[model samples]
Target: MFFAGTVKTMLPKVPSTSGKMDIIRPLAYVREKDIINFMKHNEIQAMSCGCPIEAGKVDSKRKEIKILLQELETKNPNIKQSIFNAMKNINLDYVLGYTSGNKSKG
Candidate 1:
């Protein structure tokens, strides 16, 4: 992935899982397939910290996070509680830790 010039003038490719940009990231280099997925996950984790549960979606700010988590969990049982706990989570430090490398938290 690469971004040149100012953010306004730059066009970029997806970063690897480590968030490192490259000039031409082959499929082998991208451990996460796409970087947008990382952005989405980060956004979701942030939203999870700032909302309340409601019918089918979060009631406070972002609904996309809740919907995405639901869809992800429905497809993967192991990831179910990650989203479940994110709803009740009130600590940014904990969520940031989970979003990083520690696998068990999420």
Candidate 2:
């Protein structure tokens, strides 16, 4: 995928997902500066952190995040906790020496 003056342009071709790859691989190379400039120039709101649990339509994702944050804030009035909850989760699956056992399990 590539960007062209405030527009994310993708080649008119089928995406590839062969071999061991589950997601389709993008071929074009769009510079990060170009994308950032485009977004800034066009006044784009927020960028998606690309979460797996994101569902529904493209516009709905932002709304869902806002709703979740509001609910969390209502439950717990701590600003730090709200910010912590908003941050993207770190995937611990591939982390070395990390286990899911409690103190008793040891």
Candidate 3:
């Protein structure tokens, strides 16, 4: 289901009782239309498990990192390549596993 509203309006007033449901909450605020466009562009039918949430978080982080990299590129054009190379060394599975593990503990 697609939800559109302010954070206060969209979020549940109380905690959710549904355990391990599939829901992707954006790290950065996004308009409903933008989200719809993104889904259309990516050809997504529906979300299952927590993969989409993790993927959304990763995508948002990448975008944020890209902006920072662009700013740093102004100082040293070579920085972008170095950063991208370093990013390749990241164990994404480990990272996601760690995050999910922590969530379960909470």
Candidate 4:
């Protein structure tokens, strides 16, 4: 699951409900295809950033995420299972932009 959109402000400091999730903020106006390749190379499954953060934090975030993954590996042997559970435990009801086809009639 990849999330790319406009976030009005810096991300809130939310506690990690599961394994460490990488948030990549591309630092420039790059082609989406190129960004996808970067994501693939880095194994990023989720993101929480847009143009504002992307303006000057691409390299830093990339390195930070790498370090985070490495630290997780050294600290927890069940990192894979933690990430899987994080992805699986998403509560759609709390998702800001989520919509369901099953809208109730007014």
lDDT (Cα, tens digit) per residue for candidate 3, span 21-56? 645555334644578888899997756557664566
Off by over 4 Å in 2: 1-15, 18-27, 52-106
> Taking the tens digit of each residue's C-alpha lDDT, what string does model 1 give over 34-80?
55588686774323434245443545433565566568867886574
Report per-prediction Cα RMSD to one decimal. Answer: 19.1, 14.2, 14.3, 14.4
Candidate 2 local lDDT, residue 14: 43
Clashes of 3: 0
Residues 17-48, candidate 4: write the lDDT tens digits: 46486454454335455778998999987566
Comparing 2 and 3 by lDDT, which wins? 3
Worst lDDT window (10 residues) for model 4? 2-11
Off by over 4 Å in 1: 1-61, 83-106
Please identify which of the two predictions, 1 or 4, would achieve the higher TM-score against the true structure: 4
On TM-score, the stronger of 1 and 3 is 3
Q: What are the lDDT figures for the candidates, one per model?
A: 0.47, 0.50, 0.54, 0.57
Q: Could you give candidate 2's per-residue lDDT for residues 1-106 as a string of tens digits?
A: 0222221224335445564534433523454457788889999966566764564336564566567666876777675344444333545454343334352221
Which candidate has the top score in lDDT?
A: 4
Q: Count clashing pairs, candidate 1.
A: 1
User: Which of candidates 1 and 2 is the stronger one according to lDDT?
Assistant: 2
Ranking 3 against 4 by lDDT, winner: 4
